[model samples]
Structures are given as structure tokens and as C-alpha cells.
Target: LSVVQDQIDDLKISLNISLRIVLIGKTGSGKSSSGNAVLGWSEFKSDLSQTSVTKLCQKAQGRVEGRRVEVVDTPGLFDSTMSHHEVNEEMLKCISLLAPGPHVFLLVLQIGRFTPEEKETLNLIMKAFGKDAQKFTIILFTHGDKLEDYGLSLEEFIQKKCDDSCKKLISDCGNRCHVFNNKEKDTERKYIQVRGLIKKIDDVVRANGGGCYTNEMLQEMKRKMEEMEEKFKQEMQKMQQRMEEQRDENEKVLQERDNELKELKTNIKRERTLREEEQKNCNLFFHNITIIGPYFQKCAKMNQSFAQK
Candidate 1:
């Protein structure tokens, strides 16, 4: 009975693992600051130049409402004045190592200026990931002080800049977006809001990745393999078509030669038959003719026949 009870307890403990939330955005988006805020400690390095603070992913493990929360900080991605495509590629490599897979995407941004570049970054993220991204994403806008003086709410700001791309991203993320001011005094309130966001994202994580958040890596690899297979198949089809066309051309040439051979054989047979018929007619005429004359007359007749005939 004790052993059975121990197994039951183990199952309960396994059911309560913390969720992994990954922070992604351009440099100076305040990801490190936001991570410090979330973890309630200055464990991660923050306050770097506009280029980037977090060169690699740094993880901070913490507790909120009796559940463990993992915060993954990443470097800036696709900053026109800052990072390059190589940088983004490197960050993906880092993400693969650090988080393996993440249940939530915390996109840090400044409130006062939702620049076109920032919007584009979000679009890029969606394009890279695919529809699965919708399950585990929440927008976390930093620099809330910039919004204090502004009268418009976050939804209003999004609506003002609504396009098909932005609309689709919002819709895919389950209409989940949050704005947090790192410098604000009511940080616990923001934490509660963020806590809810984590829970929501966790539900998606369990549903999509077989309770393993790192399944994105597997899915990405699978997608690449499928693309390669399709390309290979297309090339094989082209090769087969070329071979068929060549075979048809070769067959046509052989058929023409065969026809010419048949015609030549027919002409030879007709000429041979004509020659035999003429020989038979000449033999009959020679047999039917009778000549008895003097040698001189015969010789003259034969000479004349030879000359005339």
C-alpha cells in the first residue's frame, strides 16, 4: 500500500512542473529589465548599449503562486540599425540550446513608439514559426511611462495601425497582449497579470507539444525535411520526362530507317523479276528460230543480227 501511495505522489509532483516563457525582441527592448522584474532579482545582466545586452540566452528560475516560472532572455533580433540576419540566426541557435522550446513569447516593446520596425519584427516571428505560434504567445510592451501621458489604450494603438499582418498576429495569439512598466510601483499587479498570461500560455504548450515545449525544434526539422523531399521529387519527374522525350525521338529515327530499307528491298525484287522474264523470252526466241545457209551468208546475217539486235 505504501509503494502504491508513493507512485501516486510521484504522479502529482510530475503534474506540477513550471512553465517556460521566452523573451524575444530587438535590442534595448528591455528584455533583461523585464526579466529582472519577473524574477524579482538582478540575476541577469541588463543595461547594455543599443546594440544588445543579452548576447546569449540566460535563464532565471523563480516561483510565482506556488508554481515555478522560467524566464529566458534573448538578444536583439533584426534591428535595422543594430543586428543582422546572421545575428538572428545565431539567436535561433541559442534559443535551441537554452530554452529547447518555450511555452510563451514575451515580446518587449516601448509603449510610446510602436515603430514600424517593431511591428515588422512580430510579423517575421510569425512567418518563421507558423500557425502553431498562436498557441503560446503574449505581447509584453515595456516602457509604460511613455503611455502614462497618452490617453489611448493599447488596443486603440493597435487598431490605429491595423493591417492584415498585425490583425492576423493578434488573432493568432488569442487576443492576448500585456503592457508592463518596469519602473512602476505597482509591479505586483503587473506580476499577477503576467501570471495569468503564463497560465494561459501553459495550456497551449500542453496541447501542442505533447506536454513538451521543445517540440518546435522537432517540428522545424520536420518541415525542412518535407521541403527537401518535395524538391527532390520534382527533379526526378523532370528527368523522367526528358528520358521519355529522348526515347520517342530515337524511335522515330529507327522507324524512318526501317521504312527506307523496306522500299529498297521491294525495288531490288522487282528488278530481279524483270531481268528473269527478259531472259526467258530471249531463250524462247532463240529456240524457235531455224537458220541453214552458207557460211558466208550466215556469217554476214549473224554479223548484221549482232549489229542490229
Candidate 2:
């Protein structure tokens, strides 16, 4: 019994050390661009030349502000030229890169083009990715400019345009939604979004294993499953007790994140207003300068006439 217990302890430690992240989206939705954005290096080819060139899995590795950020750009599904089986094969091939499971699925989508075809394709994403996938999905929307132009916050636009099916699909993974505008060119925004993704991944791990996992769990060993589940309950109780005691601290952390997001939105709004005011002042200055130049020239001509008289 002692030896058996020792092995169980060892298995749990191994499971906690591994991290994997996979990227999925339709072609031209900016998966490759976002991948480069996350990795902070243009490791993958991002071309908009209307070609189906991504034949297989491409992986990029980097340190995202201290976290090991690994990204795999998978060949997109539902290509007009490819058959369903081909798409499935390519998707599975991508999954093979991150073997057992990925902590998060970054499902990229376009700004204003969530069409019926895309809707059907979105359903296929769930099927190919896996069932019970909501527990590990994040809806990443691209095109920040449009949302800002519409005077809609990311939260508001998601509430309005990101429909129930989209909600159910991603919320299964963890209610993680990110809107990325390719044109915005802000590195900090990308970092912030990636940080939130990592946070959701932590939540998924905690919820699933109760802070205990192992290769045996990965292998789906039934005997180990029972033992782990039982052990998980005791550990969960301790965590719950700690959480209950420190509920206020946890709330404070969440409140801080809310405040940060509000400040980001506020800053964007302030910048837009400043640009409009600057343009207004620039036009006014140029107009007055033009009129004053002509007036001075006329005054000089009148002085000449008076002197000649």
C-alpha cells in the first residue's frame, strides 16, 4: 500500500508540469497573424494571397512575459477546395502536435462576417475539436477598429453579435473572449489578451484535477481515476476552505482586472477624442494663416499707393 501510494504521488506531479496551446480558425481569419502576435516573433508565414498553402502543423515557441507560450497554426477547416475528410485529417494532424489536449483553443473569427456558412463551419469546429470542448475554448474575434467605430465595447459587441451558439461553444472552455484588430498594432493589448488566456487555462486545470493529475489520468486508467477523484475531494475541501477565508482577496484581484479593462477602454476613447480635436485645431490654424497672409499683402500694396501719391 505504501509503495502504491508513492507511485500515485509521482504521477500527479508529472501532469502539472506540462503546458500545451493550439490555434484553430477558418482560413483568412488571422490565426497565423495572431500566432505571430502571441509569440512576439514572425515565426509563421502570414500571407493574404488567397492560397491554401498551410499544408501541415507549424509550431512556434517563445516566452510570453515569463509564461511558456507555444502556438501551433493548424490548417483551417471547410476550405472550398478540400473535402470534409481532408479537413478532419488536417485538423487531427494539428492536434497531434499537442497530443493529449491543449489548455486552450483560440478560435479566431472575422469582424463583420460571421455568416451562415461560417456558422455551419463553427459547428464543425466543435465536432473536430471535441465534445465537452466548452471547458477549453476561447472565442478570439479579430478587427478592433470596427467595434470601436460602432461605439461598442468588446464586452458589448460580444454580448450583441456573438450569438448563443457561439457563447455555448466557447463558454464550455471558460468564457474567454478576445477581440484583436490586426490594424491596431498594439503589442501591449496582445500581451494582455494572452495573459487572460493563460488565466483561463489555469482555471481549467484546477477545475478538472483539483490540483492533482498524472500520466495515469492521461491514459484513462480507471483504478487510478477512482483514487485520484477521492484524493481530489479532500484537496478540493482544503482549497474551498482557503477560498472561503480569502474570498475578499480573490474578489479584489478580479476587481483589479475589471478596472484594468475599463482603463484600456477609457484610454482608447480619450485618444480618439484627442485626434478629432487635433484635426479641428489644425484646420482652423491653417485657414487663419491663409487669410492673414493675403491681408498683409493687401496692406503692403495700400502703403505703396499712398507713398506714390
Top-TM-score structure, candidate number? 1
Cα displacement (Å) at residue 9, model 1: 18
Provide the global lDDT of candidate 2 against the true structure. Answer: 0.68
lDDT of 1 at 134: 49
- How high is the lDDT of residue 301 in model 1? 87
TM-score per candidate: 0.59, 0.57
Q: How does residue 22 of candidate 2 score in lDDT?
A: 70
Error of 1 at 186 (Å): 3.7
Q: Candidate 1: what lDDT? A: 0.68
The local lDDT score (0 to 100) that residue 262 gets in candidate 2 is 99
Tens digits of lDDT, candidate 1, 1-309: 966755554454347576677787777777788887777777777774676666766777887777787777876776445445655555455346545566677777766555577777666565555445546567777876666666667687667645666666566667777776777777677687566566556555544533444556547855876898899999999999999999999999999999999999999999999999999999877665633346667789889999997
Error of 2 at 283 (Å): 99
